[model samples]
Target: MTDTSTDRFDFALLQSSNERTERRNRRLLSWLLGLVLLAAASIVALVLYLQTFEREEAERQRVADGQWLERMVRFHLRRLEEDLLALAYHARERQTRQGSVTDLPAPDPLRGGTLYHQPDVLLQHGWVPWDSSAAPMAKALRADAALDPENAAALAVMQDTARGLRRPSYAGPLLDAQGQRTDRLWLSVPLFERGLFVGTYVASLSLDQALKAAVPAWFMQNHRLERVDDQVVWANDETPSPRPRDGSYYAQLELPGTQIALYVDALKTRTPWLPRLFFGVALLFLLGMLGAVLALWRDIVKRQRVERELQAQVALRQAMENAVTTGLRAWDMEGRLLYVNPSFCRLVGYSAQELVGRSAPLPYWPANQSDELELVHRELMAQGTEAQGVEVQFQHRNGYLIDVLVHEAPLRNAEGEALGWMSSVLDISERKRAERLAQQQQEQLESLGRLVVVGEVASTLAHELNQPLGALSGFANGLLNRLQGGRIGLDEMPPVVDRMAKLADKAGRIIQRVNAFARRREMTREPLELRSYLLRVLKPTQRERQVRWQWDLGRIEAWVDADPGLLEHAVRNVSSNAVEWAMRATQGSDRAPTVRVALVRSPQQQSVAEVGISVGDSGPGVSDAQREHIFSAFHSGKEGGMGMGLAICRSVIEAHHGRIEVGIDPVLGGACFILWLPLVAPVTT
Candidate 1:
């Protein structure tokens, strides 16, 4: 019985030992499982944090891009407005010189062709001259549009609106009314002189074409530009829209003089889903391995790997920050500098060590404006709103003022509390210089235009006065010869002396008129019969040159309203040019230079009794190319020619509410210039 008891006790002890071992094993497995779960949770949290950081970064980038795009759009639009304003300014100056809006001549078509022609985005451009008649406007010029009957009504409507408003106005797409579909938008700029509405300058544009030509090609590579109404005007990838997706930002543009809601979309680089997938798979793999002995140390190994990855990410970010050219700096709420990038140091011409931790009243502030800059900084700190941008002058280490456009935002911790201000500084010194240069150039151009007009008058005065002086010298010499030779009888002496006095008087009048014109003195209008004026103008030219003059002044005598001095100058200059050219063509030939002047009432518009003075010469006809720019200031075809004759003639005709046209004379078989004049004052509606 004792031996049996001993065997049972031994078996019980063995069983108890087996139970303890099993319990220890189960507890160890539970501990390992907990460790694996903890590591997996930590990794998941890290991935989520990384993803959040990336998303925030992308959002910030998108906002910056959108703002930049908006600024660019505004800049270009403003530039276009400036062009229109410049044109208006030119028109005003012309009106002021001519003394009336109706007298303001059309600009030379070739002068500003680039402003509305090829290599530009204009679909069409024109001028509607102001009048008070039923139309209240007359078409002066048109480009890039066919003069089809269907388009007449639409054009008339546009002009009527401009005249009615007497201010800047925008019309239509101009497609439906014209029975055609096109992306044409019209803009009209009303011109006023001395508070009177005088005219309108109309321009048409294809919006998409214009925008595509303006945006930088590089910028479009990663972004898409579109209107707010879901029309994709331009895009790099030809994406119609990026709706219902992440990382898309919008910028609103309030275009001037229009109710268009313009918006631009900036697409961000998408975060790859592959990384998230890999991370998830890694976490699952780690969880599956937790039942083995290797997983115990894997928890520790995974922690080390996470730390290494974080360090790598930080290093990568630092590298990226340094690679960019944009200057970046941070300041604490107390206005102490917290950090600065390499670019910022380079921009200020200072070292990062010197700038970081520096506060207001620090180095690099311009001595004269240090207080002002400090005040601005204080104001910025006091305000919680983000700064869009501020143009500030910062003194470089070399002591020159640096023009910097600074954009600032609040730099906060993950809790969203403001820590300090972060700034991106853009060096816009070159752009500022360009703007100044452009302004100066514009002023110079205006001054140059006035000078050109003055120069033309001065040149013509010198040439025209010489003729009368030469005649006076000849007559005086002839009378002296007759008296000295003792061959002048009493009758001959009286006639010769009379002729000499008349020549002297003619010389005096020429000098007086030229002086008045050159000095820009005002003169009064005088009524003179056409026959008398033509005879007076031709007398001097006939005696001064060997050219033959023919007159076809019809019996019907008409009186003209004109400044006698100005009128005489215009007719004489043109006739003199015609005679000179005719002489050149007839050189070494028996034929003498022939200049024919004819006056007649317009047959087509005789109801108004419109009159025309047609001057024809037997000279080489003007070429098509020359005909276009013959009236342009400083354009000359003759040796030692001032090239101001035709230009002056044009100005004079326009001043009288008339127009001059050039064509081949059917009778003379040479150049013919016809000056058309209204017989009465322009009727007002």
Candidate 2:
């Protein structure tokens, strides 16, 4: 009976212990499953976060690409406008003296070169006269079909607008000569003569070809540029798209006469998903045994990566701030310096600690300029807007003034409230010194030019007056000899006296001309008859020397606007130079001293109704080595020469808006100097 009771009690105790142990095992299994589920959820969340980051990066790249495309479009448009302006300048320089636009010549560079005659992009380019009834001034340099009726009408409108506006105008995306669809752009630049509108210079360009020529090759590798319109498609790569979709950007630009939309498509880029995939696989492989440990390790690694990224960004910012040459600073409204970059401290010859947090009456401000700078600073602070760039001087730590251009903008907080002032300081001391040096050099050159003129006039005056004075003395002596010997009648005496009076008059005129030239007065141009002007220049030389003179003029009846005194000086200098050289040659050889003066017209293309004055000598011809430096100041080929004769002549001719060139005379077999002057209309008043 005792054994049965003990076994029952022990069985009950064993059953209760089993029940407790089973419950504890079930709870442990449930907790393990829950932890595994939580680890899976965390992994999923990390993957989603990575995907979001990639999407944001792609969007940022797209925005950057859009801005780049806009800049490219603007750059191309500016280039086109510049090319058009260059063409217009060429036309203006080559216009006719009569200001007639009936028949215009092409620029010298375009006459034979295929670049302008038949450019790949240009269909036609020529001038259109003011007369609406007349055809284009010149035939198309490039081969193309005749203009269609629609194109002609478009050209008419452009011409009229250019005439009315007195400026350049644009037209067309019209059909080509074949009447096929094409992107043809027509531009017209007005031709003006003395501020009078004369005609239009027309040009036709292929838009497709232009784009191909202008777009850079490197840009094409990463992005496909396309032209978008309502109905048509054009692209720099020649492959067109109806519209751009994902990973693409669009930029709109307004050209001379039309609007264009540019679409840039980004090339495909591989995303870095393999690393994320590998991480997930590793996490799953370690889940059961080291899940908790791996989770803690992952959190530590992520935190480290984030901190390293922040460190890298900070390093980049510091490098950027140090790399900039422009000094940067920040200040509060009360004029306390809040921050100073390394560049700013270096600029003022101070350390960051010495400058930052410094208040008004700052150490760098010069004592004498302190009040002025204070006033300017006060004005800038009171304006309540970003200040324009203001140039100011600062006293460096070395006690010397440093020129700096300061630009200030308002620094704003996250809520857009003005927090302080941000300043950019650029050291412009070198630039300012250069400008002052340039100004001083210019003034010196002007003074030197005046001195050169005075010296030339003085030398010429002495040389010129000697001839008339000697002639007069000889005439008076001869007359006295005849009168004392009673060998001449009253009639002969009258002729001798008249000759003596003329010599005196010639001497007086020489003095007057020299005085006029020496004064360096403003040039006064008047209509001068070409033939009479040449005769006056010949008179002085004829009286001085015994060289045979030959006149080779052809229908010379034109008038040119000239400073009469200076023109006479130039002609006299060149003719006398020829006479002197010719006489020198005659001393050693059998060749008779001869100087030929010719008046003729320049070539039609080279000058429009411009007259040429040629003075040739029968002397040793100029060598090629001497031709280049002959016209330069203080350069001479002759021994004992001051070398200012040709220089002075050039200055005179250029003052009259003409040009002079020296070369070997083909006709006379000697050195020749030709002066070309535009023939002006006779002054009515």
Candidate 3:
């Protein structure tokens, strides 16, 4: 009985020891897994964080850059405005001193020393006409009608208002609508010669050369800069898109020039602030994930291993062994190889006997990649923890490059002195090759697709040419007949002349349209009034269309960034679609089909700004099936649709960093497509 009791005690001690050993193994594994997970999550988050930061930084730079431009432009403009006001003040002073216009001309002399030469710009444009009296000479101006025929228009906008007991005289840039290249835009209070308002002294600057100088790198993208006369002044940055309908941004500058738009981007946007915040948060998340993973591993391993004996679980041990098929080698605190697996010897092409006791330092990977690798290694050594997953090429015994994915970890003694690194390698040559091939194919396909679309357009355009040719032939024949017949005298046959002229004009326009369609020309940008442009783009198309069009024509005009040809095409396409759909929906109904076009404007900017356009149709809205694939190339809904139009539309809009969206128009009860653009200034000048 005493012997049996002793055996039971012995068994109890053995079981407890077994549990302790199992617990130690479990804790080690749990900690290892926790560390791995933490490292992985942290790394992924870091990459995302950096990317987010880059975008946010870019956005911030844009806003900052814009502010710099604004300040520079504003300063120049304000200086001009102040100078004009000073001139007016001088006129008022002279009036008070002399008591009348006739006396003031010579007697008062405005008290302000007579002005010198005309501004340099007037001289540059070859129109500086100063007189012996040190004022603009009327004879000199009339002698050169080229100087300014629109002086009346420029002077018309002057308003003299009381500013704190002082008369505030002011006038600004006036765009003469009648003349394309001829306009005047500066005025001071007129100096009366004798009781009547005499000729006002004006300062003017030609935008012709100034505009060309304003062109910058970004401005050169997706546009062509043109003068107001539709003359292509400069053309580059034309491959992807046409420039703004006109390269014009709006702001009434107190400058020597008429209020004309100067510059505009194809799309308008508000400053973005989220990317920075996102990057920062992602970085924090990476750190947090690392901590959580470490904790989770500790908790799981502690619970499983410390509470039970696991040595007897032969299956678990065997599973671990099978999972690690590569060669393994472990070093002790003294840097001596404690164990070397058979697999390890095979990998190195060296026997264990020869490797053992020999200090075989691992080779530095891909000599070209050494600098980068060393940076990572230095960080790892300093932290005593590693961030892995860098790729490297290893020189094998066969003297060939082994494409590898590398991983590493630190080895430490109980005292925590760093010993060395344990590492694993994976051959990924096949993966790398596959990725390269895929990338090449993707690029090739994109090029092919673009070419195919161009070819198809060419074919379709040929068919459309026939109708225009017939119209031109008939118009030409009629014009010839009218000119030959004495019954249609040039002086007496007004009605016939008008009829033939209209027909001839129609034929010319058709030819122009065909000519434009035949080639992919760059967009021509010029200053354009946003409100006026919308009206012009809509009025004729809507009137000619079968759809009943609705719109809210606002009074405010904005100068927007756009390419005229591209704008015409995009707007025409959208309007055409809306009209077509609206007509189809109301085919048998008594109500006329309606297409609603709206110009959305924001009042935040002093100039008409933050403008957008929306085109909607009273028809069956897009189905769920269509919405998902709407922007996909060669994807379409209508039976005869080629599907390139919307795809091209999206590409063009995105190129300008603008978006096009389709949704149900709550007001119209049908599908609505929206286009947003920034309105900087108007092109009126």
Least well predicted 10-residue stretch by lDDT in candidate 3? 123-132
Give RMSD to native, each candidate: 47.1, 41.2, 44.5
Worst 10 residues of 1 by lDDT: 8-17
Residue runs of model 2 more than 4 Å from their true location after superposition: 1-311, 319-326, 330-342, 345-392, 397-399, 405-465, 472-563, 577-596, 600-611, 617-671, 676-685
What TM-score against the true fold does each predicted structure earn? 0.31, 0.37, 0.33
Q: List runs of model 1 lying over 4 Å from the truth.
A: 1-454, 477-497, 535-550, 555-559, 587-593, 600-609, 681-685
Residue-by-residue lDDT tens digits, candidate 3, 416-505:
887865556566667888989999999899788767756645533443344445655775677678778744556755665565666566
- For 1-685, candidate 2 gives per-residue lDDT tens digits of 3567655322222221235545665575567666767777777777787788778777787778768767765676455544555666666555544354545565555233222333466766655555543535334412222457766665567667778877666666666677765677776777777888766667777766666655566666777777765456677767766666766777675554555567777676436566567656757654643565555456655555555566666776788899898999988888788998888888889998988888877889999999998898886666533445888899899999999998888888999998888889999999999999999999999899888777777766656676689889999898889889999999778888998999998788778766765675677787888887898768868877888888887664878989887788789889989998999888967778999998878777864678989999998878998888998756777786767678778878887788999888877789999998998876554
Candidate 1 clashes: the total is 1
Report clashes for each candidate as comma-separated counts: 1, 0, 24
Which one is best on TM-score? Answer: 2
Judge candidate 3 against the unseen true structure and give its global Cα lDDT, from 0 to 1: 0.54
> Among these predicted structures, which one has the highest lDDT?
2
Give one digit per residue, the lDDT tens place, for model 1 in 381-453: 7763355688888888988888888887889999999999888888999999999999999999978876875
Residues forming the 10-long window of minimal summed lDDT in candidate 2: 8-17
The lDDT, on a scale of 0 to 1, for candidate 2 is 0.74
Clashing pairs for predicted structure model 1, backbone only: 132-685
